[model samples]
Target chain A: MKRIAKLSTLSVLVLIMVFVAACGKSGNNNNNASPSPKASEAAAAPAAESAAASESSQPADKKVVLGFAQVGAESGWRSANTKSIQESAATAGFDLKFSDAQQKQENQIKAIRSYIQQKVDVIAFSPVVESGWDTVLKEAKEAGIPVILTDRAVDSEDTSLYKTFIGSDFVEEGRKAGQWLVDQYKDASGEVNIVELQGTTGSAPANDRKSGFLDVITSNPNLKIIASQTGDFTRAKGKEVMQAFLQANKKIDVLYAHNDDMALGAIQAIEAAGLKPGVDIKIISVDGVHDGIQAASEGKINFIVECNPLLGPQLMTAVNDVLAGKDIPLRIVTEEGTFTSEQALAALPNRQY
Target chain B: MNRMFRHHLFWPLAILAALLLFNLFYSPDFFNIVMRNGHMYGSLIDILNFGAPLVLVAIGMTLVIATKGIDLSVGSIVAIAGALACLTISRGTDQNALSLVLSAVGLTVGLSFFLGAWNGFLVATTGIQPIIATLILMVAGRGIAQLITSGQIITVTSDTYNYIGNGALAALPFSIFIVAAIYLIVSLLTRKTALGLFIESVGCNPQASRLIGIRSRLIIITVYMFCGLCAGIAGLILSSNVASADGNNAGLWYELDAILAVVIGGTSLNGGRFYLTGTVIGALIIQTLTTTIYMIGVPPEITLVVKAFVVLTVCLIQSEVFRKKVVQRWKTRRYPAEREVSRHV
Candidate 1:
């Protein structure tokens, strides 16, 4: 019994030591830590402004603190979108309380409620999904806080719940992709056996893209979707499903991916099957990501429809306009266009967002 | 008869039957099968193909759980294995069938084994909780995999590697065959030998097992190692099928699915008895449910809510109150001869 007790004590000590070691290792290898020159500049600017404001004759009224609950960095585009919002908030002189929901709706709702309790002047969020926001939005409205939808729209029937939505027209983006495909494959005699790699099944992009593409493509009887599968907006699953499609179907002419990741995955699968992706199987994808543009330039992808993720400047302008009692459109669509191989190459270097 | 009824396999069979019955009226063509390209094509086939990875994970999970331990790191291990295989093959190595396959398999298994040992060392030697110990790897494994692949999807054009994931034998997926072979090996190693008994003994009463001269710590470590090996195999299969290694997304959320499969298989999360066959059925149920949702054209967003509901219902039925109610109903509906058998038991 004594030996057992001693052994247990030793084990407990070892466990503590091991945990410390693990934590120490993680601390040394912090991946999220990056040198932020912009952050430092912004911090210094705030101090300078406060000093200048104190010296001024007129004292500033109550400060407006706005809380922005961002959907976590779900994709590269999402990360850029969040950065835009953060930078814009800092520049606009609002105390921005940002919380990343990490792609979970419950976390977003919680953050919104916390912001409401804090009595933030305004609330903004890029919801992780469309549904389950009506109740929260209603609560925000009751709390006398105006909410702005960014990048993506919510599915609330109550339009008065949100002040305004600032983002790209996702359906139009799909229509553009469809129209481009129609133009490219107009001369093909045989059936245009297309395989569509969809985004997240229930999200706005997947639903709208599917509807919009179908609306345009259904007119052409030859353009049939031989296989349509959800790649879940992920590259890995896209490749897997594409492989399954190749194994199951012999004739696949065109690949229409919901996003660049899926398109890239499909490209990998196409190359693995010993077929040229852009030549043998024409590829058209959305989201003008750097890699996607590079692929298009390299003749691996045929066409790309840009879904602009940088909405900071426009969003901030809309917010200021609304606050200044200026009329704003219910939906402010970002300016976006399609790009072919030549265009992709021309814009590859200058592409910022 | 009482013993048979109390067996873990019996619960999964009952749950599967109940789900099928529920789906029969609600879902059209639930049992419909079609032949295409000399292979079966239908919702059922799709379910089997999709559930293959989950089945593999659950089988590994069963052994781990039987040892009173859990491996939350299987998902990451899968990513690492895929990354290793893809990186290795993309290096323009000789396409000689035997060497290529062996090296890929060896590297994946070896790395996984090392990771598993890390988990084992933490849990067994240091006395850390299995969940917490494995969680470390779970959080960092994908990042490690990404580092291995340099955050790039390594695409390979190897027929030998592709055959593991995409190939078929006798009109069935090669993955299904692999799962079957793994099940056989695991069953033999555990059930047919003293390993299973030892694991159960250790799980049921750790102190007693130690008193009886069983090396409980060694057993725990070995179980984790086996789970790692299984995950490595799963990773190979996943990468091979896609013919690419995507470290960022490979086997993402697989751990959750595997744990869900294990729980649905009637294996108590608290640990004790294990049922390999039940795990297979549980995996099938999950895949079939997913396919059914897709076939019914339910919007993808509501699938999570639906899955949660199904899991809730299954858990409710598995509860003691529900079991008692079921038994009472069964007793009332039975014939006199059946009643006599029940009374005798």
Candidate 2:
């Protein structure tokens, strides 16, 4: 009995340690520690980097250390964004300390605090949520570390907390989708019936996207959204909900999915229901993910509003300007484009995500 | 009549029927089944097709609950199994090859068994609470899945693999046949042998059963392993249906749904008697509610609220005490003088 008890206790301890280690490793990538300051600075001697990097670096000996805390890899878009940031940081010859928050605001906050303690030259983070970040941003400000917001913004009233915010406007993407649909049906006579597949309810993207689309489509009374449902930003839910939508309604003129994944799922449902997706019911979707772009090129979807995940090159420029004592805009929106089948076909070969 | 009413499955089936009837009233064509391209298509067919995963998971959950244990890690297992399978298939040169699809599926199920064994080891051997033991995997399993898929959705184009989720057999969904086979096999395994009685005995009093020479610990582990196997199969169907496996979103909240199905099926959470058929009915009710909500065109924002109310009504109806109280109140309201006279007599 005593031996068994001892063994079990030892095993439990081992298991607990394993879990803690896994939790720590899964979120927050601290792998690129840059092998001490001297070696990285020596290796980063090439002045043939980005234009901003070449101009900002006067002394090759001193390397700018940047700490970036990213939201977890929840979707394809998020992972692409993370990749861009990491690659851009490497190209700019900045010592980047990257942390994955695993979709937790508390983890992001902790990462930022650690960066502050380390006295990094600059701090950048794509916050997991908009609210409850004022305190953490305030701490970074007091610590004399300038902060940059990427992909998402904090809800703090103070403008000085983050030097600049960089991301695609979700609402603007929605408006672009609505505008494209309006343009498509401008010359037509009959009312165009639309069914909306929304993202997770109450999420910033879902609320903003819905509002933006409504803001645009309400102008033209010819376009009507007969039914709307949340797919929780997932493909399976998208197909399931779309099936019901098809069964309930006899005719669906258009489908506006909050993201590409849902749109793809809806396309499958449409095909299964014996209707050609782009021809029978026009599909307008946001998020120019590779899969979404491919669908557009295939003529399965009619229009797509690009929500670009590649913000790294632009973010690097902003960081360089900040270090060079050059003033930058407070809200730096990434330039995004809309894609039709023709444009999508031409852009398919060059698509990254 | 009383015995039939008192059966464990009675309230669950009634509730499911009531839900279906409500849908029929709400939409006249709710029960219409049409054949299109050799496949059955309708709201009813969809409930069965979509609810197959939940039913499979709940069947295994019923057995685990019968052995007085809860498997909270089933959702994570579902995600892990799908991620592993999709990753394997995607790496193969010919995704459509029968050998590759089989190997991928075999590897997924094998991994699930190992994961289940780990949970069983912790719970049965170390005497950890079932909830706590499984919660470890529930938290870490998604991360492991993400690692397997490299944080990207792995989409596969294998017709063979898609057959499990989308292909029709005999004018009905192939998923329904899978659910039926599993249900039959599980029922036979538990009922045909002494396994069912032993499970109930262990659940009733583990110490007494062990003292009586029953291997309670082995039974607990076996039940959990079975649960893992069921989750793995469910994972396969889910990923195959979408032709992609999303490590982050696949099988999210499935464990809760399975547990709810078990509870609503009239299986006591305290653990003793189990009802496999009732659990199936419970799963159907849930799927039906979701479909009804969509068919009724309930606003997207309040969809959850509507679902919660329907589930609450089902649970309330399943409670014997609640039913008796309701019936007694109706009797008293209708016959106040008769009640007083009977009391005096």
Candidate 3:
């Protein structure tokens, strides 16, 4: 009995240690090991002191202290967004305190409260979801921390909760994808059979993208969507669902996927079925992810509308404007472009993510 | 022969028939099959091919539930198995080597088996509840899978490997063949040996079975191991079908589907009786339901509502007490009205 007790105790301790180590690993994304909870506090204490010192000594050129709460690295696009934000923060010389929300809205809310306590100059977060953020944004407002929404938007009725939203217009991105398809198949002699691979069902991107695509294609009598199913924005489900679509329908001309991942998955299904993807079954997907661009360059995807995740520079510029007592726009849309195979090939060499 | 009609298999079979009949209303060509280049192509074929993975997992799950145990980690085990298999093939020196793919599969299955044994050890030896014991792995398994895939979806392309998932055999999808093989092997092994009787006895009363010289602990461990092996095979089929492994979504919520399959197949959570046939039918019903959803154009968002209603209907039909009550209510209503009319006459 004593042996079992001792073993259990040792195991618990080991688990705690492993958890702390994992935290340190993710926390050290900037190459500095904040090592322990106390270490972070110690580092923050000196910064706070220096901040007070700079208040009296240097007023005009004080480095803005920015706290960023990011949704976790669920996909390549998300990680790219995080990297861009972190890099731009470094170049902009902002004291960036980053927190990974791990795809949970509660974690983002908690991180925001902590940033408020830390009295950071600006707060930025790419919300995990669209709702349930009114209270936290209000708290940040009360704390005098201007909030910036990056990569995703919030559904708060109080528009003043966020200073500005700097991200690609998801609906526009979907419209571009649909318009490309409509232009290509406009002169088709017969009905063009189209299949759709959607992102996660009920998600913002999935719903908006579907609506936008539908709006454009609704006017075209020749284009008909034979089937539409949720791929859940994952590669495995995309392939499985695409395989079924192929089996169910004898003829399929176009596949409009909501995202690059699902499109990539469908490419495999098309190849497995002994048909060329971009040529035989034309594909137009949103999100210019690196793999998707590479696939476009290889002619596996016909067109890819860009939903640029590089919102860093724009986000930082908004932060600077807010901190310098300058008025910024309530909505800042990032400029993105659609790409062809040639453009994809030319841009693939310089793709960062 | 008359008494045989009252068996549990009757209800599940009836539900399956009704579902098939319902599919015809939406999909006029639901039963159509064509030979395209010596390969079967049809919606009906898709149901069988896609449901094969679920059938394999549910067979193992039925056995576990028969032992009065639940294995919640089956989905996570699936993710891990697929991740490891894809990782090996993607990083292999000779990418298309049959030997490499075969060995990778073997290794993935073995590791999953070990994980199942770990769950069994906690439940059987440590005296933890089965749910909690398996929950430990269910929560950590995806993270482990992510670690193996290096936090990215690992995609591989190998003709030899892809054959396990997307290949056709005699005008049918290869996945259906895999399920048939697994079902035959498990049923034969369980029926031929004393294993089935032993498992039933243990499930009926673990303490009495232990007194009667049945090693309940060993039986529990064996079922979990079997369940893990089944999930590993499912993972392989799924990842092969897509030619990619995603730790997060590979088998998400499949454990629930498996449990639903077992319960809907007439295997009680209270333990004792087991039915592989019922489980197979249950898996078919589920796959058919998914196809029906798409065919009916239920809209992807509201499909679950329809699935839930169908599941509830099946459950109600399965309950003999509920059926008896319904019959009684009909008799009382009709007979009383008839009696009043006769009295008036």
Best by lDDT: 2
**Per-residue lDDT tens digits of candidate 3, residues B1-345?**
757769879889988889988877655678888776677767788788778889999998998898899999999999999999999999898878999999999999999899888888777877789999899889778767766765567778788888888889987889998889989988888899889988888789989999999999999999999999999999999988877787767888899999999998989998988999999999899988887776665667787888999999989999889999998998877567888999999
Model 1 — TM-score against the truth? 0.69
lDDT of 2 at A332: 91
| Model 3, global lDDT | 0.83
Q: Which candidate leads the pack in DockQ?
A: 2
DockQ of each: 0.16, 0.52, 0.35
DockQ of model 2, rounded to 2 decimals: 0.52
Judge candidate 2 at residue A238 and give its lDDT: 93
Candidate 3: stretches off by over 4 Å: A1-75, A82-123, A139-146, A244-251, A270-276, A312-326, B1-4, B334-337
List the RMSD of every prediction in angstroms.
7.8, 4.6, 5.6
Q: Please say which candidate is ahead in TM-score: 1 or 3.
A: 3
lDDT rank, highest first?
Answer: 2, 3, 1
The alpha-carbon lDDT assigned to residue B48 of candidate 1 equals 71
lDDT for each residue of candidate 2 in B88-195, tens digit (9 for 90 to 100): 999999999999999999999999898888888778888899999999999888878887776778889899999889999999999999999999998898889999
